[model samples]
Target: MSTTLSSRKRKRGLSDAKQSDSLSIELSSLSDTQTGPVLASFPYLTLPKNTPFNVSVRGEEEGKEFVRCSSTIAGETDAIEFSGSANDGSDGAGSRYFLALHRPGSSKLILQPTPVYLISRQVKALKNFKPTEPSSSEHFQARSMLGKVFGTKKAKAAIDAQERNKIDVSAMEDVVGVLQDRIDEGTENLPTQEKLQDSANAARLIPAYNADAERPEDIYPLHNIIPEPEWAALDSLLSKLKNAADDRSRVRLLPNARSDWLRQHLMLAYSSPKPKRKIAKMLIYASVMFAFRGVAGRNVPERSALLERLSPAPEVVVDGLLARFTETPRGSTKARMTSENETNLLTHLFSLCLKVDDYATDTALIASDLKMSPTRVNDLFKSLGVTRLFNVVMTDQLMFVEIASGCTIGKLSSQDLKRLGLPDSVGQEKRAILKAPLTFPKPRLRRRA
Candidate 1:
């Protein structure tokens, strides 16, 4: 009807074949660069060897027979050529060629390259037909033909990059450091508990007996490997995590029966009032992540060993510190934040804690550079604490996911959670986070009595 890109050249019902025998495919007059037409409008017909066919039916009616054609052209061809590949390699690749054929609905078959699946058989056999796109058909074909093309190393490399999102080990370390800095600064002001007993209990959380102050940077890799000697334990665990490709690998390692232990923690430096609670929350998160990493891969035993050896939080904590200090604050505080402000300022800080991105930019941090909480600031940490929980796992654990499974998204994620490699439940309704302006909430000055 229309003579533009939307219009079809041939009439609608011309290609609708009536029966199998009536169909006669002609390809004797094909030129190198031209597409030809139908010889006989039969529902079922076979192509002679070297007899090429091309039908221009971008949008045809439903429930019609479309030819299922696949070809392994030589290195170069005079005919119209296009590359084919799969979304993911399936059935060792090349075992199933899934090109869409002409029929009332979509169908694919695992055809041997030499003896391609016939349209007559495919159409007759396809019971319930579904609509499919050309791209999908192409992907199916490519996936089927993958091994016939690419090398093993090439495929593995592609998988490796995707699973870990390509996060270098050093970058992750930096992000953890930033969170540590914010968490460390935020707890500077915890309203000195005036009540005698409450203060006593609170002091227990932050033990004052620190003759040898432990800086976040001063953790030997051996710290997590206690009870068992460091050299023996680290070597054993490292081997398990590295070699845990299949179930057998994990089975060979790990203890026979041990409580599924995890060492989760949040290492950030925010100016929150209750540093103790923040530290507690950090530990909980680290435990969640540790459990996830421990059980992240193929074997339960290897997962256990990996998790045990992997809770090196100090490096991540140090990295978080460096990331927070690297950025210059955006020059303005006129825009104060409030808890009810629906403008997601505090969650951003939480994301920084989670290492979603490299910068620490919660709108609440718009106050002064030396963000000490003279009154209290733990409210900010509490405000967006739950939201931060998901992020911490998502960002931090993504690397391990890649390392374990060579994938980071899709069906693999649920598998990760089920194995205790990730938290089973997420998005729990925690307390609502509220943003507040950087007002120090200073007490009123007392007049001299």
Candidate 2:
């Protein structure tokens, strides 16, 4: 009986040894064989204390160039490592293999032959897992461990020389004077217009404007405040007023209700504690009739009262002058622009130059300098006139001029310019220039027998 027991024991020992050898061989095979190349990876990013990013597998999908893992990494979690390649088209029409980090204890990257969702059924169970307060010190300690290991030290950002320099806003002729200084220094030493408020800043930055003073610069800031609906409504109303056959149609066009709305809107824009000149200008210039009418009646006693609170826009003044200059009597061959009309136009231009950067540029002057044809210069002027607030009129004299806003005439005069703070010297200069016979259109001499 003892011999039989010994034989059974020997057999059991041999069987156990065989099982151990097979398990060892399987382990060796797994360690030696690589499934596929690592596809995508992100460097381990340090997180703030007690803060963590959540990572979750979205889904698997085929992409145009590569198989999109569709995994989204977001949330409050500790440091995570993700490295994997799930590409089936390795041989051809696939992403070229890349050198990968073969670091010890890295993420276990799997390359499944087919696209598949990675999240398991156990994740659904986690959805119902209610978070509880720390019942034990171990839970608290584990949470706190992350803060100690991966907290980042943030250094204050250094301010550069450009950032340290405060914006120097010098209004009037000072803008041009500074611009000229910068240009004279050298092209490489030009000042940057970083955080520049308006076109005045842009003008100072541009070397071309500083080089030539008379050039009509695009100093006006672009305002695309009007929407399509509002523009259409305005245009429609304007067209009706223009084509109105009789006084009744004209009266209908300028109804009392509409006038009231305009007056209120204008006052709101102009009388704000800190009035926006641009907004006020936009409201006033919506229609020619509205702008010329000005706020009237019991609500406003004197024109001086309105003028005191709100100044007339340069745009309105210029537009009105252009309209007057272009307006002709029914049978007249010459333009109906008066001596005052010429003076106002000149005064506005002179005043504009002193304020805005290179606000006045002579493109025609530039064309003439470049030896461009007269016809070409004229065409250029027309194109530029549409884009610019004003154009340069170079006949006998160099004058910065904006074309009429529309065919309709305006009531703006020299009296308006005086209210707008035009100096007496500028008005006198304009009058003298206009009185010169060469400045005016010469009358045709009649052929006698």
Candidate 3:
């Protein structure tokens, strides 16, 4: 029995040895196949804090490029480390990694690709990664931001210069003399009085006026004048008017119920006993009008006349003269402009209607500047040979005026009319004129008287 058990144990030991030898042979084969490293080492990236970026690995599959893995590193993240291995087990051979950076307030994404090499059993890192310097556009954006927070340098300088030029009350006469001298010097190049008069006489005549035409009830609507208020609050209202987003908003700021409020305030200021108060009011009025000329429509003439009637100053007269240059006749008339200045000014203003940027001009803006009713401005433009266009954009009170190139100031040539893209005449019709005279006899009577 003992001899039989020993033989059975020997057989079992031989089977165990055979199994161990087969396992060793399989391990040796695997080692030989994987002589080089099976795992790939990729470099880690260190980025700036609060910088948003993305990292991606790309590889070619079937001759087409594709992303292998991607990760988004948000702002406040500073380091990027590989978390896991890829499933394909190709070790990213012949592949590249890229970093994508986002630009603030823009849809553009900046891509930076880096060539990757598989190194055996070693991790790589960038030793000299420097943050890129800001470009010129970025610098400009930064400067603009600073300007928004603090006023621009140019505005600051202007304010400082104004402060420096402030004068005492006693030097008012000298300042006036200096200003008059400057005005005279500037007018040296303007047309002479005789030339101006000749130009006025030769100017184009307006259309004949019709006495039977009726005027609209709202042609010259009365403004709701407000009494005096705190000067600072008045200034705030003026600022609001000036900074309004659009023409409609500006008009809303001074609706008919509050129209000419600034002028009313100015009159009240003039009535004050203090001369300084009067001057302050005048300056405020002038500044507001200069900044926003379209305010209160072209009723600047009415305001000037009122001021003149109440205050009776040389300044008021000067304001009236200035306003006269912008005023046009209320209705069409055969008469020429009363003054050479008016003719010249109207000619210049009409020329401005022809802009290089647009094919049409908004005559409503022109009418506002000229202080004429829209219908009167339209008539004037029609006399000047411009075609009025319908407002396709549905904007309120917008009258577009268009003139063909090479058209004369007051005449529309047949060629100009054709170029204007108007529909052709249906047919050419001919007509003839006939002149006839009738002969009548006269009778003599003597006895009745």
Candidate 4:
């Protein structure tokens, strides 16, 4: 009896193990039986497969048509029928549609008109919201603005036509000839060479706003302060210095003749027999002014030397700079000493002060004198190293650079001098201590004697 029971128990255990294994296999096969790869999906749309199929979508949102895609395998005929859920002949909400392709078994994709439908709907709404006609006054105002910038619509049309066709210069010859002919018939005489030259010069001369863009030769700041001949001489001196290879080279290239002329004026200004000699005073003034201009423009390196010889007396230097406030430089014949030229010359003189350090006054006050804000004054001083604020700390034998730069100091990386408003001559060096003796100073007790 015991042996029979043992055989039955072993058979039952093996049968139970086989059943569990079969169940696990069936579950895995069922999980694997899913649709093919998904192509794309969005909030309202998805492409499940890149095969022969049809798409049907219909919906509406906020008076705008919405599209929903329902895909199906293709059939014998490529045509797919679409029927809306709305019976009132108007496509409504809660619609169901299917897209079928040509083959029943083979999968192929059919492009939908959803994008076109949305674009057309938007365009239609925009057309309805836009005004059909604008008021006459508003139309004219808009037309005037357009005409000022780009001429009338008719002119723009003509330009567009010209651009569409190849442009032939020969076509303009006839128009030019017609204009010249009309001018000749209307006038008794043609403009003379002198008049033509004058016209050309008038056109070539830039407005004061664009003075910086003009060539250095064309900048005319000395016109009123110095006579024409004196102005020409001074300009020549500056040009010679500017053409030098560098600032040091510029100092060597200074014209002795001009310096002598300048010195004579300075002597005349201080020790001449005639104290009120206006010509001598003007010459002295011009010399100082031109020197300031050179320094401000970075075209001369000996400006500080020139200032020293011009006026050893700081009071005289301050007085001379102040007097310029009243003296006006010549501008266009109609406007003597225009605001633009005055501001430019004043700015140059301000920059020259930083280079020379002639004025002992506070920088903020100096900026006020120059008609500039204190911040701008500090910026200029930092850039030229006039204040020595950006200097690195140094000891007798060792240099300690917590921060070093051309412009500003920091504990880490170096930065541009300009950004820190510092002169480029400033630099930084990194160092590391190799080793040091671990010795301590010994203190000696007072001797008993």
Q: How many residue pairs clash in all the candidates, one count each?
A: 59, 9, 1, 12
Q: Rank the candidates by lDDT, best first.
A: 3, 4, 2, 1
Shift of residue 275 alpha carbon in model 1, Å: 31
Residue pairs clashing, model 3: 298-371
The model with the greater TM-score, 1 or 2, is 2
lDDT for model 1? 0.30
Q: What is the TM-score of each candidate against the true structure?
A: 0.15, 0.18, 0.18, 0.22
Candidate 1 per-residue lDDT over residues 1-449, each given as its tens digit: 11112223445677754322222222223332232222222233433457443333223322222222222111112432222212121212354322222333322222111112222223323446677767975874566467436648777566555545755778678589899899988976755434543554333211111112242112111122121232222343443334445433432343211212111111121123333433333333333232332233222233234335544322343223223212223793222222222113222223323321111122223212113351123334333211101111233323211111100111223543354233545322121222222112323333332
> What are the per-residue Cα lDDT tens digits for candidate 3 across 1-449?
01111122334545554332111111111222122212334345444555543323333333322223221121223333333334244534665555545556643444444323332222224435667999986885676566656877886576566557766668687688888899999999998766764564345442122212232111111110111332333454455544556544544444121324333333433354442433333334333332223332244335444344323223432344345434556684222224444444443333223321011334455455556676665554444331222223322544333232111213233553465333335112111110112111232222321
Candidate 1: lDDT of 163?
46
C-alpha RMSD (angstroms) for model 4: 26.7
Candidates in order: C-alpha RMSD to true structure? 29.5, 26.4, 30.0, 26.7
lDDT of each: 0.30, 0.34, 0.37, 0.36
TM-score of 3: 0.18
> TM-score: which is higher, 1 or 3?
3
- Choose 3 or 4, whichever is better by TM-score: 4
lDDT of 2: 0.34
Sum up the clashes in candidate 2: 9
Provide the lowest-lDDT 10-residue window in model 2.
430-439
The total of clashing pairs for model 1 equals: 59
